[model samples]
Target: MNQLKVELIVDNRVNRSTLSGNGIRNAVSLQPVLYVGGIPNNNHINLTGSGLNAYGFQGCLSSFIVDGRLLDYQRALVLN
Candidate 1:
């Protein structure tokens, strides 16, 4: 089975605002869908390490949904 990985990097703050907004509400900001024609005997699709926030949310404000799943998390960022 062939497998593929997809990663989406975005600004947590901006993405969260967009999601909360009335417009563009029911759409996945990152990796909406995949179109593949024909059928494969053995094929595997994996969603790993996606929707990564480029810069960690600097406060308790920012969220997003992936595949109809909502994830809310906010904390201070420590850089080394």
Candidate 2:
């Protein structure tokens, strides 16, 4: 099986607000689901999403799992 590394660039303040927000309130603004799919190579893979902004999120990617299995991964961004 191959592992996929997911990256998320979320607003730190918004994420914190959401974490602290009760069910009635929403923290950061809701973003569309981000999907990255591609062949795996080396230790990293390039990803693209439909709704992703040109300026990616600064926060770390969390809750990442591949095929129901969890693994440690990192992101190295290449700006174009």
Highest lDDT, which number? 1
- The lDDT values for all models are 0.33, 0.32
RMSD value for candidate 1: 15.2
Look at candidate 1 and tell me the lDDT of residue 54. Answer: 28
lDDT of 1 by residue, 5-54 (tens): 33334553222321222222222234443222322336333223332222
Worst 10 residues of 1 by lDDT: 17-26
After aligning candidate 2 to the native by TM-score, how far in Å is the CA of 47 from where it should be?
12
Distance from true location, Cα of 7 in model 2, Å: 12
State candidate 1's TM-score: 0.20
User: Please, what are the lDDT tens digits per residue for candidate 2 over residues 41-61?
Assistant: 442322232222234334456
- Deviating ranges (above 4 Å) for candidate 2: 1-49, 74-80
lDDT of 1: 0.33
Highest TM-score scorer:
2
Q: Whole-model lDDT, candidate 2?
A: 0.32
